[model samples]
Target: MQIYLPIAEMSVNLFLLVGLGGIVGVLSGMFGVGGGFLMTPLLFFIGIPPAIAVASEANQILGASTSGAIAHFKRRTVDVKMGLLLVLGGVVGSAFGVELFGILKNLGQLELIIKICYVFFLGIIGLLMFVESIRALRDIKKNKKRLKKRHHSWMQGLPLKMRFRASNLYISSIPALVIGFFVGILAAIMGVGGGFIMVPAMIYILGMPTKVVVGTSLFQIIFVTGTTTFLHASKNFSVDIVLATLLLIGGVVGAQIGTRLGLRLQSEQLRILLAILVLSMCFKIALELFVAPQEIYLLLRRI
Candidate 1:
């Protein structure tokens, strides 16, 4: 069935949109990532304007993340204090990102910048996760002795330490704030929930336990993506509510299923799967960069 996207000024297959949403939603649930990274690119592949794709994907992410967050909260896994702190930074960062996005759009560099950012970040994060997960799996298979936890690190020495009872750690809020800030900027710019980066940062950089990382990341993603959605709607007028609704319908349900499946998988296995998915996306985007395009120039309607 065909559906019109008023904001995008185009028609698309309804089932295709829903199927894309479902696929991304499953990933969102499984990895606590918003799936926007995957969905936005698919939107581009489907011929949606990049701006429209990014903005609308943010709205869709809000719905998926909400569902995932609720599931995590019901399990009492979310870290409320940590999530709030991250949200605080995320809000500020998103504002900056939106402003930069506007400038890039006006200069006609927004799409290029988005693609480059995706390639760089995804490649780095994917490789790291893949290696780490493989090592973790190996250690598990060999029944290696657990190493002692290192309490002292550069982050621990930083000032303004705060306790995160749910995460069971006392660390400087500064690192958390910084992490959230960057993630928020990326979230707005890339139409992603920033979980792909946030999850690893929480695990490796902030020393957060794996159990709480997914839930906490989702909690922050909800507000971050919601803010981006509203900003895109108001500033760029690019958010397609109709498109978002269809995607959300499939995404929300997929997320629920994914979350349940995630619970059944081992942490190492989950990380490996997520790593592979990220790398695949990175490879696809990179290939597009090298391949020649069918259209060299395009017409744009006057604003």
Candidate 2:
């Protein structure tokens, strides 16, 4: 069935949209990402406008991450204080990012900008993860215990520091705020939950325990994505409710299935798989920028 998206002003296949959502959701559950990193591009590939994809994906993330956050809260794994601090910075960043998005849209540079951002970030992140995971995998094969290297102590040290009992850290609020703010901008611009970046920063940069990092990232993401969604809907009017609903249905189910599958896979394997996926996406998007379309041949004949 085909459905018209009023906001996006496009007609797309209903089942296709649902299937895309499920695929991204499965990746999200298995990899602990917001899926926006993958989903937003998938939307573009399927003919959705970049602005529409970003806005509607935010709504999908808000729905998908909600249950995860709630489950973490119930389990007492969420660091509420740190999460709130992240939210505080994310709100401001979200508002600013929305404004930037609008300006880029009006300037007719939105699609190019979004794709370039994806290509650049995904390439760098994917390469790093792939290298790191490969080493870990090799160590496992050799039955060698991985050495625990100390993390970088380069975290910021601004004033107004507080203790987070859940994370068991006595750090300055500056680092968390900064991380949240940067991610908020990405969320508004990239339509991601920002967990892919947020989780790593928490564990390695902020020195937060791995136990609480996922839950804390999800908790902050809920509010950040919510703010971004509202801004996109009100300012750009790009959010497609029907599209978001379809994605939600598929994402919820896919997540459950992915979680079960993830448990059966080794962590190193999963990281390597995800890294390959990300790099593949990055290369594909990069090709779009350089590859000439078939129509170019017809235009060249005139020359």
- Top-TM-score candidate index: 2
Off-target runs (Cα >4 Å) in candidate 1 are: 145-152, 260-277, 301-303
Alpha carbon lDDT of each predicted model: 0.85, 0.87
Off by more than 4 A, model 2: 145-157, 292-303
Tens-place lDDT per residue, model 1, 1-303, is 999899999999999999888888877777666678888888988999888888888888888777668889999899999889899989899888888988888888888888898899889978988998898889989989656343547886899999999999899998889999998899889888888789878887888888899999999999999999888888888899999999999888887788788898775788887899889988888887888978889666433
Please give the lDDT score at residue 29 for candidate 2.
82
TM-score of each: 0.88, 0.92
TM-score of 2: 0.92
